[model samples]
Target: MRPARTTVATAVAAVAALTAVTGCADKTDAASGGKGGPAVHVTAKDDSCAVSTASFAAGHVQLAVENQGSRVTEVELLFPDGRIATERENLGPGTRATVTAEVKAGTYNIACIPGMKGQGIRKKVTVTGGTAERRDPAKDAAVDAYRAYAQAQADATLPKVKTFTDAVRAGDIPAARKAFAPSRVGWERTEPVAESFGDIDPKTDTRADGLEDGQKWTGWHALEKQLWQDKKLSADSKALADQLDKDLADWQQRVGRAEITPTSMANGAKELLDEVATNKITGEEDRYSHTDLSDFQANVDGAQKAYELLKPVARKNDPALSAELDKQFAAIDTLLAKYHDSHSSDGFVAYTKVAPAQRKQLSDGVNALAEPLSKLAAAVVK
Candidate 1:
């Protein structure tokens, strides 16, 4: 997802203002903090993802990945097909995170993501015997849903980024500007799963404000500065464009190769809204360009997709909740349908165009969905 330099054409900033009023930004601080299961400690370094053992029995397991490296890192447990049995990501230096999972008797690998970016370090492992473990249908279905969701987003968004970058490289300012928001829809829609790649998300779409000191800003927003703000094209733009092209290609190849689960999908869906609740709504994300609406809509779309995938599980677990979620999503749909964006190819209005009252209406709608969506992972996993 790339940003262009410019003002908010679609007045979606109102959505952000309401989000701030509603205190949604704090959602990013939420953590799973796994409890109970035997904690498997995995230490991540620049060169290696150090783990105590390579064997896990078929059952519930809690894995903690510690970022011992100077740069941020993440650890993932992958089965043979690159499916994530469990993962803990974005652990800053010296910070530790955990992944609680139930694994069957199968071989697994450890993917050590370094620098909070890049194709991480990989290692092998063996999962030994346990009780005759059976896969829960709902959980199994959710895994499939997440896998399809990840792959679909990658496939849809990858080519779009290339086209956008090509316009940037060729100095087609107007074309790239128009391509910016729509192209990001794919990435935004896949936020929860796509972000698991450690470095790629930051590289593709990290905002300048989110960057720590000394962090080299490169990616979509890097090009966004030149494209919309300066309204001029140069080597700087082309270079960032080229780098973005490479990073996107890498991401396209890497995503969807990992296993998906219901819990993560539900969790990811909620997190997507949290992003909207905090950044998109508050305009912290679309700082340079005011196209927050496109991203905002895409996030809701992605979250909706996750919910759709898990609908069966939800219905089986709690019909009332499932019905309520449907109505909640429908309400947002009706609300957003009325939004008219000026810059976006779609007709949604400028982020700033929507009134605070209307923005609050949408915010409340999302928060409502979040309540039921939040319970999805646990309800289905159970």
Candidate 2:
């Protein structure tokens, strides 16, 4: 089934912000690090994907991919030389596979397709010096920090999702619409990827009527039409609403009642990270109009709050994990600072500074962090 779009959107935005600060790094200077063999680890889910490093060395590369989403996911590895080193298809949820390929270094892209065209995750990795380094403590800490930030963010906003879903279930369209912005703020940073839906205008789309016109509706406009414009609602609309409520309820129950163990926190982090990564790579826009970078900034703020609440428990359970979590927070701070500087008050103002190709490069650069961040979350909980 299609997962909750609003939650995914908020998560994507938060992820993007986090990536902007902590995940985005230049790895062209390969000689600075110690000599090591080349290896890459990747994780894939219905909503996202992750990679081990943004840069790597050329040679024999081993890519480990894991699917964490509820639906089937696929991952493909591409080389700058225009070659597909490996393609893993139909990797069901909670399953993983490894692929070995001879990579010639330079740069590469990893694409994960969870749904629709352009509705997939893509990341760029650099292969420098012909070798890769094993996991470093600092790198590990950064990953943990990112995971902790994501988990905290999700925890804070999940209640808002429940509220929205409840209003929808009660047929309170106005309430549901009102609740949309607060809930969607969590994933607003990754608007570029979230807006890629062909049938929807991520800027002003919505999904008011469930399964109507067979048009694959999306965004706030679609939602507005469904709630205020559409004169018709299929029998499935009620059912969909019911399902939506149930999904939100389930999420609330799981998140609220579930023990705040490392595993659970890690799982939550994984989900958020996946959403973020997917949006970064896929550029699927949200269905809500207000779901923008500012909204995402709010989500990041919420995540910070959540992290504070869970900090003690996270540290008590794993000190190393806690330290890592701090790194992610720092990274996020850096990213937001940079993003704010680049965008000014408007969204993506830096877009005008770069060539079209460079803009694409920026997008690609953002995608590279998806898998690594997700894996870092997994490591914390695992």
Scored by lDDT, the top model is: 1
Global lDDT of each model?
Answer: 0.68, 0.45
> Across residues 1-382, which tens digit of lDDT does each residue of candidate 2 receive?
1222235554454334434433322111121221234446677766667887898666545566666777556566665543345454444456554444445557778888763224378888887666453444543554455445444544565577567656666777767666665655533421211222212222223333223334454333344345544534344555555454444333333332222323223323333334433332233333333233334344345444444455555565567766766766556555545445442433432323335464344344334433333333323321
TM-score of each: 0.70, 0.38
Q: Rate residue 84 of model 2 by lDDT.
A: 42
- Write the residue-wise lDDT of candidate 1 on 182-296 in tens digits: 7788788886666665457767788775454577788877777777777787667888888887887787787756545666677677667667765676555766667777788
TM-score of 1: 0.70
Identify the leading candidate in terms of TM-score. Answer: 1
Angstrom error of the Cα, residue 164, model 2: value is: 6.7
Q: After superposition, how far is residue 25 of candidate 1 from its true place, in Å?
A: 14
